[model samples]
Target chain A: MPSSPSNQSYHHGSLRAALLSHAMELLDTKGIEGVSIRAVARLAGVAHSAPANHFPNKRSLMSALAARIFNQLENEVLAQMETTSGQRAERVMAFAEAVVAFALTYPHRYRLLWRRESLIDHDAELHSAMEAVYALLIGTIEGEDDEFTTSLETRAIAIWSMVHGYLIMRLDGNLMEKTDELTQAPRHRAIITALLEGIGGGPSGARRDC
Target chain B: MPSSPSNQSYHHGSLRAALLSHAMELLDTKGIEGVSIRAVARLAGVAHSAPANHFPNKRSLMSALAARIFNQLENEVLAQMETTSGQRAERVMAFAEAVVAFALTYPHRYRLLWRRESLIDHDAELHSAMEAVYALLIGTIEGEDDEFTTSLETRAIAIWSMVHGYLIMRLDGNLMEKTDELTQAPRHRAIITALLEGIGGGPSGARRDC
Candidate 1:
């Protein structure tokens, strides 16, 4: 119960940092089911009960870990947005690329973030981080000057779902990575344009300046 | 190793069929991990070696079960497509509705279909069923007459990814079910339309008749 002071390697905020670092390693190597408070503590070379102050149970530990991962994702998207030329379509492309890069780089972490069942009460910090990313993405679409039949939320959801599904498919080996030959663009760029320009002139294909 | 002749409850093709039925029960109630050769054998009240004639291991058992489930999903989609009005967009809507219904009704079964890692060599029957369903969806898009910057395959992938993403999010309870207030269409319908018409006229928003 009072092992914090006795531990020389872990003291103050350092212990929490050590625990989280070890927790991420476990998550990356063994997936979410392999992670536990005791396992993380053991990995960190601390007493099993030492993590109690930071994470009381496995669920809380997972919740905190997920929140931390989402924060990284949020920062990635924000950094991409900040560096973009700020055009609506350009920002959309940048946003999609940032998310795809994140998912590809840390596939397991990306998977853990969406698996709400494995975390605790849908942790508030995690929720906010996710919402912030969504808000950032939607902000780009909201800047469009023309009127459309669908709401901004619909447009946002459509893009998000498409990217999310496409990302998961590639990560799971259900789909392959490809590129557009004529335009010399990644398949994702083609896909995003396909949605932006409509397909085969079905209801919204006219490029008129209306 | 199986005493099939002596067991009064099992005779002829019934043992194989019985094993499959119990395997599905395990899949529905306990997910993919719950169903295995040993577990199905035990559940069917047969010797552990009883399933050896039909399935050599957990992978083969899951492969057969996945094939059967894909057959069911294929039939559901075919029936929906057949009943559609033969219009391109109408058939597209019908195809999307059928898949959404199937995923909703058998969420666990739907989940297993895409999870190739749990099955054996991506069983031939299962592969054919999936290809057939995909061809059916792509057929609708191939009927479009106007010139499109994106190839037919790109267009197909875009809609497919959007619908797939939407379905998974709803199933996982990550996204709430909502309807389009202006057109009184389900959010899925709106999403489909959003992709169809493009958004805010970034490149394809004009509804002009060309």
Candidate 2:
């Protein structure tokens, strides 16, 4: 997987990215406990101390990796928004679907993004990236309705929690075993729609009368 | 902590409980990685092999612990339901509050209860216990309303996802940092209320009109 650094020598700027990439691979296969600076350096085909130049400790490396995941998550959500054209509730469902898709695609990395210990020290960058995603959700919920009096931030948190929680439960197989169906996408969409409806809205624009 | 099995002899049933108690303490302080069958035996002052007799392996021990947590969660939710007298939405909010409180009180144990690997082997029992909790929530939502066409199961899942997701985010300090207020109870209540509202209901019993 190491591309020989392209120039046959690891550039200083690329070393950090290489270490992070290798560490993520280790995490996918061996989990968080399997990753270490030395292992990442070895996987990158660099000197043992090479990773130290970029990440002072294991925690820092994990933090950087988490930050990268958050950035990716933000980008993915924005990308989904760009391609989906619908009413506010439909658009929100699209965001939820994108999040579930991302988590299902990379379950380990998605879990790592929410690891409390790893993200504690990287709050500033991680929070900023996460906030961008939340902004999209909040804006969609707010939409063109200037009379909406409920706190948009609170709505965003609830929506994010519902969708994120569903993804986690799905990954853990909690949702699948309860139903006879082999697939949970339809159920998940229904749950999301119900939650949206509970918030005083719906896919059919029923809340406009309220 | 072992109490010498209380009869100066290691009874099989008591030994299992003692080991699980010690293991939970270890889980709370040192996390899941800190727990092991041997370590639990050592901490409980039992013979090293004592735990092996009851648990058979580390996964078995962890599975037992997870089952206990689910049972405890069910009890807590049931207790909340008992004392809470209100319309459907308020009662559901009470259940949500109880969950968040339990998770906040024992964050590590709460996380352990949902670990996919740990509970995979114990799915039948664990799912049964969790199903009881969901039944309570579904019953509350379905209360005296035969005309409610939405799936109670889907509503239950959405409510669970929102509340569980909020607790995880709160434990990670994601919710606290975004707000100036030190307390999250009110914010949590608000979020739950909004989600319920989105489902075409509210704390004021307005969904009856639907």
Each predicted complex: what DockQ? 0.40, 0.40
Clash number for candidate 2: 14
Q: What are the Cα lDDT values of the candidates? A: 0.74, 0.73
RMSD to true structure for each model, in Å: 5.2, 4.9
Clashing pairs in 1: none
lDDT by residue (A1-210, candidate 2, tens digit) is 344454464464477777888888998898766787788888887888877787777778888888888888888888888888877777888888788888878888888877776555545777787777777777666645333323556767878888888877877777555562644456667777777666222233332211
Q: What class would a CAPRI assessor give candidate 2's docking?
A: acceptable
True contacts kept of 2: 0.49
What number of clashing residue pairs does each candidate have, in the order they appear?
A: 0, 14
Model 2 CA lDDT for position A15: 77
- What is model 1's DockQ versus the real complex? 0.40
lDDT of 2 at B81: 85
Off by over 4 Å in 2: A1-13, A29-38, A46-50, A146-149, A180-184, A199-210, B1-13, B47-50, B146-149, B180-183, B199-210
lDDT of 2 at B10: 43
In angstroms, the error of model 1 at B78 is 0.8
TM-score of chain A of each: 0.81, 0.82
